[model samples]
Target chain A: MNVLVYGAGQLAQMMYLAGAPLNLNVLAVDVANKTVVHPVEKTVLPQSLEQAINDADVLTVEFEHVPEELLLVAEESGKLSPNLQSILVGADRVREKHLLESLNIANCEHEIITDIAQLDGICERLGEKIIFKSSRDGYDGYGQWRSSTAADLPELKNIFTKLDLHKVPIVAEKMCPFTRELSLLGARNESGEIVVYPLAQNTHHEGQLHTSIAPAPLLSEALQAQALDIFTRLAEKLEYVGVLAVELFEHDGVLLVNELAPRVHNSGHWSMHGADTCQFENHLRAVCALPLGSTEHGPAAAMINIIGCNTFSKNFLSISGVHFHWYGKTVREKRKMGHINVTANSYADLADKFGNLSEYLPMEFFPKLLADADRIK
Target chain B: MNVLVYGAGQLAQMMYLAGAPLNLNVLAVDVANKTVVHPVEKTVLPQSLEQAINDADVLTVEFEHVPEELLLVAEESGKLSPNLQSILVGADRVREKHLLESLNIANCEHEIITDIAQLDGICERLGEKIIFKSSRDGYDGYGQWRSSTAADLPELKNIFTKLDLHKVPIVAEKMCPFTRELSLLGARNESGEIVVYPLAQNTHHEGQLHTSIAPAPLLSEALQAQALDIFTRLAEKLEYVGVLAVELFEHDGVLLVNELAPRVHNSGHWSMHGADTCQFENHLRAVCALPLGSTEHGPAAAMINIIGCNTFSKNFLSISGVHFHWYGKTVREKRKMGHINVTANSYADLADKFGNLSEYLPMEFFPKLLADADRIK
Candidate 1:
């Protein structure tokens, strides 16, 4: 079977690798050029995008933010998985909020500001701490703002007023004070069979995912059950047919939906070694209508992103269960170069591996390395 | 780093997949045409063999049967691991026998026959039960024959008389029989760091490998250590810098050397799911001079070759720890199309999985599966 993914990035490259052993020929469309390409090499393939789509048994996206025009064309093919609305929901915060509301899913209390004037008394309505985010991605001057007090509202408004709110609205969310971020990666096949990998606790640095510890250490069964229930409701409601990532915030033993990614997620990358079936394989399986593999994980696993700095050598791989994955990308400031997946006998062992991992990585880049390692125990 | 492998087949394809994650660009030399090609697609690359050799940081072979002419050129590049001798030893039974003899290795008593006339009373010298094998591959009428008594010698001679024994020669050996076949896969890196996966018990049907149970259930420590010792000796003698496989015949709690492969071997395929590092990745790591990975295996594992059978579906993948790998070849009688790697909690669990696996595999093709499954425990 042929699977055509809409973005030629690391995710697609991973999907290609995962699909190969299963005899699934995965091709990618470089959304930037709208041309079919080999995901790994990022080299243009000898086929038009239309030809690729027509040849593909299933069409999917590596990223939810695929160009609306391209997505429309793909959706019209009647082969796109997760469907258009689900993808739009992932791409647009407003749409995502509506999805949560429609499903009665637990999420951060928020309000959508379609117009600039709606910002008036927004802090009072929401909370003292409000996080204002651009409802949709890929727009000029789109960014986020945080409001702590009423005094900072003017400066936040000054930054927000420059944007065309009518074109790309603002989602004002009352910042929920949570313990930590966790993401559940699950897949819904065409047959409506659902399988979810263990939830992974994510640690972010500068708004980018730095690391993920799977099975989210110390997580209560209730929290896990809650996440699963929410995922089932969302997937069934959307009739989702592919891997869906639900970012959640756990507060006082309650789980709240923070965001959604309608594709294989970075947090779940540990599954490549940790779980019996990886997210990429499950995603391809779901989209291709193959049997969903078991989401069972063996040992405690963690994924650490190799961001920006390329100073590390292959020496750290000397550690057992340390699998290095380089995306083969050129080094740039804050660019996601690659990642490392580590499997350990226990959480304490993982913590030790994490501490040992710090010795190899540039300390300036991985600021949380040793601290997080020490914290894991 | 680029690793050029000779012989564009499933082995090379697997090597490509394993190398990709470590940022190793693996390409294959289709020895028949002497052209560089993508291992997975078998598509001719834009580069010539010379360019591939020049560009590769290391050169290796997926199959020892790579044409000597190509091996010579790869050797000239001063990058081929295991070197020319090791690969030649694997390609020719005579050279392998010589290697074992020189190393004082234990093997079946054998005689080299350069002339068909030398076969006189061969059954008396070796035994009534003797096996005659062509010393080299890739020649007309190169095959194995057995003789049970003096009565069968005349017919065996009749068959051997047609060949030019002066060039290829024949190896007549006492057919040692006792217990099952097992193979040890190990790697020696540039720094002389060696690691060996646990011995894998092999089952053969009609001279073709049918199944491999890893950690070779209930193996004695002494036997395992003996295999590891012999492997260490052979690898050190050759100063081997890649994965080396030693096929053994276990008799009376002793392991006698049967054959050697200079590259990855089929028996080690179970490592794809069972061990901390797969043979392909370890082969790449060895050749790339990277640190060797742990040989730790997680559970009882088995690898079943999908020989000439394309009757199975993806449904069997629903079995947890069942990993399917298709070579994407058109099935032909007695040809290897792909393989399945299964990991189980125990030998009993493995047996149950094997029985379950037979339901999906064509019974006629996998005739030994159920029987072997029953015998595992």
Candidate 2:
């Protein structure tokens, strides 16, 4: 069996590992070069984009930001997953909000701002503080604007005045005081058989995910079920296959959808070693119309992202229950270097063992910083 | 972190998976090639064999057949695990019998046949039914002679007369009836932490394993404890690091050691998905002087081997909860092609699922014809 993954990134590399043992040949398309190559085979081939797509049993994307024309071509060939509609909604915040509203799913209340007047109306209807976001090219805290007070709204709106509203619309949402952030990673097969992994509690720094703990320290069973329900409804509505990670905000025991990532997610990285079958392998199975895998969690798992560092100690090599994954990228600059997964018999034990991991991490960016910054507590 | 593995095969490939993530570089030196390479990086560079030994934090093997010279080098390096004494015993039937006899471990009572005329004397000291085996280069029912009747002894003697018995001595032992075959996959770290996975009931045909069932159905707790005790003693006695698989034979209420593999064994493959930390990952951790991983089992799992034959249906792809792993080897008659792992809520459920597996298998060489195989009861 052959599969054509639309993007050449870490996720595609991981998917290659999961696909290789099953004798599934995966060709990663470097869209920038329009050349197809096998990651493990390391073969550079002279195949046209159309020919590659036609040869694949299925076509999928690693990220949502693929060229729309290529996606249209894939859809025409009857191989694209989650469909163009789902990708469009995920790509555009306005369409995402509309879809959630149409499905009666509870999300952060927001307004679509196409003009300065629309921003004023949104502020009048909502509150003094809001988050203004560009409809496209935004991730990891980029392409965003913030209004902390009513006095700041006019200035923020003025900055967007020169842009075409239709081409670059702004979405303003109410800022909620949430208790915690959680994510649900689940997979829905073509037959609608959905399996949800244990909810994960994620901690972020500077809008970038630094760590995630599985089974979420101390979440209520009720809240976990509610989160699963939200993800299930979204997957069914989208007619989705493969893994879906739904990021949620917990405010006063109530869960609200923050965003949805319709592919293998960072929050699910622990599943690679902490679950019966990893999310990547299972996602491949789901997309290929194969059987779904068990979603049971391991004893306890914690995954730490190794970001912005090129070199690390070989000492970590001797750490117990530690598994390292390095993306074979040559250059590294705040690019997600790789990840470290640690599993233990108990959550506290795992935390205790990995608590001092950052200290051992080569501090290229902030040398001699206080030890507290390196601690996991 | 650096590690030296003795054999380079699929198990080494998997241990590579566990080590690659932690930046723990494992150098596997194939006895045949005398060449070492990183399985994940897939890079080949030359280093002094002794230098590779010196670089490792700890040393272990994928199998026990590593040449004695290499074992001595690692032992002299102070990193060889399971010790050279134990490995030598594992590699040669002569030392194995001597060690077993010294430890008072029960086995097929035998006499060393250094001369052809000794067969009659050996038969008299042992029993009427006897099995003869070469001291080295014997595995999977190869390089052995079986004598079930007196009529066979003359032919066996004549065959041995054609060769030099002094150069290649053989062990002749009494044959005993066994109720079933079983194995224990266990681990020991330098710190003396010991973990034993559930005993597996194995079925082999022509000496090659065909299937393995975890928690062997209807097994008594006493039997399980006996197996664990035997493994613990062997590990401690050898000062073993990394995983060890002890194959045994059950004759009535007593279990006797059949052979010992001082590394990851095929019977333990189910642990890749059935346990919290797979044997490959745990083996690396154990050898690297890291904490051992949990040996907890999943609900239930059964792994079936896919031996030689390239024409099997991909339909196993349709079975939910089934995982297929194919080794990338040039196809050959009776070679290990791949395996399929089936997991379910219960063993009965897994057996039921195995019923449909034949549909995806190459039926020509299937053990039973369809009519007889259909009768599961």
Candidate 3:
């Protein structure tokens, strides 16, 4: 079967790799250039995007922010998986929050602010400390504003006015005092068969994902059940197909929905080495309506992002279980160039290898690893 | 760095898949058309083979049978790994045998026969039971003949005459009574760092590899040492870089070298899932002069080739540890369409999963699995 993926980026490149062994032809559309690039070979050839999409048996997206016009064209073909609605919900923070609230799912207290005037009463109602995120086109902490205290609200209001918050609006959320961040990745097929990956503990740096560890060490059954429950409710409610990542905040023992990513996610990259089947492959399988593979986890696994740096020595492979995945992209500041996934027989072994990995990478890129090393030990 | 692979076949496709995550551009040249095909995308675009070769930082081959002219060009560029001589030795049975003997590696008693008359006294000289293989362009069970008894010699001689055996010549070997077939895959970098995967027990059907189990069940340390010793000697002698697979025959307690594959071999497919570093990635690493990854094996693993069939249900993935690799080839008689690799915490778990996989595959293609089920139990 052939699959056409919207957005020719690293995720698409990875999906292309995972699909090859499954006998699936994965083609990527360069949304920016209106051309197609071979995900693995990266060869820009003379082929019309329309012709490629017309030839594909299935259409999917690697990122939620795919152009709406392209998505409408794919939707007309009736091949797009997880549907346009699900992707739209993931793209717009306001819609996502509304969907969660409709299902009575536990989520951070928030209000949609379309006008600067609406921001006046938001802090009084929710809290003084809040994070304001663009309802659309926001990622990696971009298009976001934070109010540390009531004193900072007027300054934030002024900035919002300058940015014309009336058009795009902003999701003002009361910052929850969560102990740690976690993400749950789940795949649902057209047949409604759902499989969820183990919860992964995630750490972010400068608003970008820095590291993730699967089976989230010291996780309790109660917390896992809560996260999976939230994932299932959202997946079934949306009639979702393919992989969906729900970023959550673990506040005390309860889990609250933080955001949703309607695609294979970076936090689940460890599954490439740590699970029986990875999220990329599973996502493809789901989109193609193939039987989902097992989501069984290995003993212990961690993924460290190779952000904005491609100069790390390939000598990192000398460290056992360290599997490097360079995205074959030109390095840019704060961009995810690639990632490294490491698996071990035990948590202690994973920690030891991760510690060794920290030594190989620049300290600036591995703050999460440096901090987690001690906790893991 | 870019890698130009000489053959655009399944092995090259796999190499392409493995290299993408390493930030390496892996391009394949179609020797017949003198064009380049993206391995994952399979797009036959307009590009000159010479231009691709010129753009590549390193040049390698997916098989040993690359045309001599291309090898000469790559050798002239000083970018070929394993070098032209090593590949040439791998392609020619006579040269391979000579090299083995020069290294004093234990091998089946053999002689080079150029004429039918040379085969006259070979049966008497070597033994009654023997096998004849073409000196070049042989793979799987093709270009091979076997004699069961002394009475069969005249018919074999007649067949060889019809086949014009004198042109390519043949290597006649006394068949060794062996307990089982085993293979060792090892990689040597340009910097002289070598790492070897665990020995794998291989089973063949009608001379085509059917299945392979790694860390070869009940393996003795002495046998592993012997296999590694032979591999090191051959690799060092050839000054080989990249992965080399040595097929061996376990006769009584001794391991006899059966053949050498200068590139990745079918028996090492299990490494895709069973080893910390797969043969394809390590091969790329060695060729690119990057540090070789560890060769640590998972507890137990098995790989079954999906030969001449693509009709098997992908539902087999529901079985834990079952990983399918479809080569994206048009199915044809005796063609290796794809393979499945499975790993488990123990041999018994692997055996159980293998047994389950056999049920999902056609009986015609899985005789080895059926037989192994009982042995594993």
lDDT (Cα, tens digit) per residue for candidate 2, span B264-286:
88888877766766788778767
- Alpha carbon lDDT at B302, candidate 1: 91
> Residues A45-91, candidate 2, lDDT per residue (tens digit)?
67888799989998887787777777788889888776777777777
In model 3, residue pairs whose N, Cα or C atoms come closer than 3 Å (at least 3 residues apart or on different chains), thus clashing, are A326-B21
Cα lDDT, model 3, residue B253: 87
Better of 1 and 2 by DockQ: 1
TM values, all candidates: 0.99, 0.82, 0.94
Q: Considering only chain B, what TM-score does candidate 1 achieve? A: 0.98
lDDT of 2 at B339: 77
Query: Best-fitting candidate, measured by DockQ?
Result: 1
- Residue lDDT tens for model 1, A1-377: 99999998899999989999999999999998888998887878899999899999899999999999999999999999979999999999998999899988989999998877887888779877998899998888897888888788888778877888888999999999999899999999989999998889999999999999998998778888889999999999999999999999988888899999999999999999898889999999899888898888865999999999877778898999999988888999999999999999999999999988877878888877777787788
Q: How big is the positional error of residue B369 in model 2, measured in Å on the Cα after superposition?
A: 14
Per-candidate Cα lDDT values, in order, are 0.90, 0.75, 0.87
| Model with the higher lDDT, candidate 1 or 2 | 1
Native interface contacts retained, candidate 1? 0.74
Q: Tell me how much of the true interface, by contacts, candidate 2 captures.
A: 0.47
